[model samples]
Each structure stands twice: as structure tokens, then as C-alpha cells.
Target: MKCTEVNRLLNPYIDGELDLQNVLAVEAHLQECPRCNAAIAGIQTMRTAISRACEPAKAPLRLREAVQAQFAGTAAPRQATSLSLGVCLAAAPGIAALLIVGWLALAQPWNAQSNAGTAQGTRIVYHLAGGNHVKANLRTLKNHLDAEPNLQVVVVAHSDGINFLLQGAKDTEGQPYIGALRELRARGVEFRVCTNTLTRQQIDTRAVVPEAVLVPSGIAEISRLQKREGYTYLRL
Candidate 1:
């Protein structure tokens, strides 16, 4: 099998979705290809980082009480209802997961200083996941810096957020966004583009604007910044 064929099959192979024949072909190709092997390692590292970052957080007492109340409120009258304490307890985990997802979707900007033991200084990780808000987000960043000159900012881009970081990418005025990116870089803001997105989208590394640095995984990088570097998380 050729490198291109193996590259196409890498994800399926990792997921154990490839049939035996194709699996063997990909493995054989990987054995002789350093590049493919490194790709697999990078993916596995990202998976591990994500897994660590996603470990189930204990539901807050209020949320748990609300969930329990919700379950109780919807139950039929005692004589007709089959709901029990054991059933509610058993269902708590799944309900908590859904509630957590919803909470994340509705979450506002979080300041690291509010948490004990977080590092000092105003360190922020501004996360971007869509192309539509690039200009607005950058404007917000500029305003933030103007308000707090000593603040440290890192812009982490993934998915369609990487669009503005591509070479020749333009803003509403038909001017390239790279000029704004360069200005931001000059102001000590770091722009990180995800290499995983690049590979999945088949974008050449050189196609990214020189002002942005490529990281293994934008999500993983965000996780690291929040958990390990004490950076506040702001998704915009």
C-alpha cells in the first residue's frame, strides 16, 4: 500500500474499522514509513490528552438536586409510578453528562483568578471554533489588551477558525487578515493553528500565515493552557 492509501486509512485503522486485509496493508506500510508512524503517535497523544481533560467532573450539589427534583416532578403518582430512589441514582450519571454539556454551551467567560492556586497575572486562552467571528474576536482581543496592557493572550484556532489564519485570507474590506494577525503578533498575542485540522483538511503547512504557530491539537493545547498553565478560558 502507498503512503496516501495508508494516510486515508489511518483514522479507520485507529478505530478498528478496517477489515483484516486493509489493516495488514496499512500496518505493513506503517512499518517502513517514519512519517506515518509519527502521525499515529501524534494522534494517540492527542487522544490521551483529550481523555485526561474530559474526566468526569462531579456534578455540583445544586445541579444534582435540580436533576433529582426534575426526575421527581415528572414522576406519576406514587400508586402508578415505577420510579424509585435506586432508578434515579442509576440515571444521575447520564443526566449529569447532558446537563454538563448544556452548561458548557451556555457558559460565560471564566476568570482564572477566581480559582484558588491559579497562577498570577491575567493569562487567557481565547478559543475560536468558527470562521464567522474572526474579525469580531480579534477586535475584542485588541480592546482587551488596550484595557489591560500587561495581559497575556493566546488565540487557539481549530475547525473553521483556522480559515482566517490561512495565507491570503481576507477580511470584509477585501484586505488580507494576515496584516491584522501580524499586528496582533507584534503586540505579544500568540496565534496557534491546529495541525490536526490541517492534516484532516489536506492543507499544506506552508499555506498557513507565517504569523501563526502550528500545534499538534488545538483542543489539547487549550486543555493544557487551562489545566497546566493556569490560563482563563474564553470561548468566542
Candidate 2:
């Protein structure tokens, strides 16, 4: 990884948001790049300082009761009555302090934890089984890859879904899918086809797209990625 890429990923790395692949890349770069290492150290120091500065003090009982009542769908106590100018001036300091404390208490670090994989970047297994929406599915995959450069994505296509992976296949709108598929492949997306489905449909393996890897079973691949590799599954 270059210094520019490492700089872009530094915040996520600090917040534990990077996947295993990216984490390794960033760590490797940091070891060789003294400037990048110092930058990360400064970031860590800033984070620690802010966390300590924003440490929350206990909230008043009234505020706790009001918050609890809101969550429980119960009526809360009425707001305080209007105060005279002199009374308002007297209470302003305390109100400001309360607001500051409350805000600090609610403040949190930007720690993006992936539910799919613990201590790793996000890994997703997208299931494509409908012919009518093949274009949409591929489009969504491209959008996801564009949005999350660090994401690990795999598309498992079987049955009708495998139609899109066939050589010379066009989408519902009669537009070819190869161009988009190629671009996504360049972005680290993996396309998998079910050999079982091809056999059932009497489709030739030679006719499948060169980009797709043949898996024994689509469902089995999905299950294996989810159970063994901690990939999140989504069907479309």
C-alpha cells in the first residue's frame, strides 16, 4: 500500500474498522514509513485526549427519569414553568453546565464494528437466483464495491442466476453484463457459478464466463463462507 492509501485508511484502522487484508497492508506500510507511523501515533494521542476530556459525569435523577419514560412510551413530567429575567439569569449557568455534561455523556468514538466478522473487515456473500433482476443485482454489487473499497465481496449464482454468468449473456434490457462484470472484477469482486446447476441445465462449462469460478454447489458455498469464513449472506 502507498502512503496516500495508508493516510486514507488511517482513521478506520484506528477505529478497528479495517478488515484483515487491509489491516495487514496498513501495518506493513506503517512499519516502513516513519512519517505514517508518527501520524498514526498523533491520531492515537488525540483520540485518547478527547476521550478523557469528554468523560461523562452522572446525570441528575430528573434527566434519567425523563429519558427512561421516553423510551418506555410513557408520559414524562412537564417542563419547568417560564422564569423571570432575573431567575433565568440565575439558572443559566447551571443549565449550561447540565447541557455540556449531557452532550459529553452521549459522545462516543467512531468505532465501526463489523457484525459479519469479528476483528476483521466486512465480508459479504450475495446470492443471485432470479434472472429478471440479474442486472439489478450486478448493479447493486458494483455500487457496493464503489462505496466500500475495503469490502470483501462474493456473488454466488446458481439456477436461473447463472444465466448472467454465461458467455454473451445480456440483461433484461438487452445490455451485455460483461463490461460491468469486468469492472467489478478489477475492484476485487469474485463471481462464483454452481457446477450442479450447470449440469442440471445441460449448460457447457466452456460457455461460462472466464471470470467466474465453478463451485460444486451454490448453497453449499454460501453456507461455507458464512459458517467458516464469517461472511454475511444476502439474497436478491
Candidate 3:
């Protein structure tokens, strides 16, 4: 092997990482090669000097004094090696940890109690399955609106319930119910009509209730509100 190639193996030999065969090959080159031998000796000397200089720290009197002062609530006298803001950030992981813990401690209860009762009030969903019992549910919804006045109500009309909300439809007085529904909506009661039933009955979107927004499916929409968004469901 050339001197350059022989010199390359000297450090790995000191560290003892090479295989026995490669070590013998390098040794064989080194025995006859004076130039490679001197290079290996120089490397060994440098390695010894580096290893000796890099030693474990011995705490000095000044270091002990600073540590004692910090524990005793006295100021740590600033030094040239005083922690930079970046070092403070890296060294003091507990500071950020404490802040996160504090934020969670303060935030949990307030957020947990948010759905207890709204200042404006709760939202009630009137689930109506139409046919003969439609009248009873309509009256129940009307009665609640008359009683509370402030509570927000949503009438999710699907199937046969759409007939009662049509223009000139009576609310037990031969008076048109559409105007009353519109007026209730103005007072914060919303009417959400099921578009799926409309399609089943061959009724156009323009046919029933101007205030109603057509949802894809009545059951799916009700389930979404009740499960996902925390709205209370009442079957009328």
C-alpha cells in the first residue's frame, strides 16, 4: 500500500475498529514504511494531547458561590457566560411546561360549563312525523312559543308536516298559519324543511315555506345536530 493509504488506516487502528485481517495488512505496510510510521506516531501524540485536555469539570469556588446564591434567593451575579435568551429557553423547559399547565387549569372549567345554558337560552328542535298527529305537534310548538317567547325554536318539517305550513293553512282559527310561521321566524324561530321528502312527493323547492332551507336528509340532519353539535332533540 502507498504511504497515503497506509496513513489512512492509522486512526482506525488506534480506535481498534478494523478487522484483524485489515489490521495485519496495515501493520505489514507500517513495518517496512518509515514515512507511514512517523505519520502514525504524530497522530498518536495529537490524540493523546486532545484526550488529556478534554477533562471532566471540577466545580470552582465561584461556581459554588453562584449556585448557593441562586438557592438562597439572592441574584446570580451576571458573568460573561450568563445564559442568553436562547440558552434560557433551551435550559428552562419547565417554565413553558408550567405556563401550559396553568393555562389548562384556568381554561378547562370555563369551556366545560359553556354549554350549561346560553344567556339567550337553549335551542329546541321540534321533530314532527306527519299524518294525523301533525296538528298536535303544531299546537305543542305554538304553545311553547307563546309561553317562552324568548327561546329559539327550530321546526324541522319533513313528510306530511309541510301541509300545515302552507299559505292560508289554519292555526285552529281559520287564520292563515304561514303568516304566523313567518312572524315566529322573525322572532328567532327557524323553519328547516327536509328536501328529501319534497323530492319523494314530487314537490319543488319553491312549493313549500319560503323561510325553510332544504337539507339533504331529515334524520341525518337531526342526528348531526344532536350528536355532533349538542343540540337537544324533541319529538313532536
Return the top candidate by lDDT.
1
Off by over 4 Å in 2: 1-120
Badly placed stretches (over 4 Å) of model 3 are 1-117, 133-136, 167-174
Total backbone collisions, model 1: 0
The segments of candidate 1 whose C-alpha lies over 4 angstroms from its true place after superposition are 1-120
User: Candidate 2: how large is its RMSD?
Assistant: 27.9
User: What TM-score does model 2 achieve against the real structure?
Assistant: 0.51
lDDT values, one for every candidate: 0.70, 0.69, 0.59
Scored against the true structure, residue 124 in model 1 reaches a CA lDDT of 69
lDDT of 3 by residue, 49-123 (tens): 988999878986645543342222112222222111233224435343432322232222134333622456655
Q: What is the full ranking by lDDT, best candidate first? A: 1, 2, 3
Q: Output the lDDT of residue 94, model 3.
A: 39
User: Can you write out model 2's per-residue Cα lDDT over 116-235, one digit (the tens) per residue?
Assistant: 443454676777665665555566566666666677888899988899899999976788889988988988889999999999999999999999999988877876775557565555
lDDT of 1 by residue, 195-236 (tens): 999999999999998889999988778767765665555555
- The lowest-lDDT stretch of 10 consecutive residues in candidate 3 is 74-83
TM-score, predicted candidate 3 vs. hidden true structure: 0.46
Q: 2 or 3: which has the higher lDDT?
A: 2
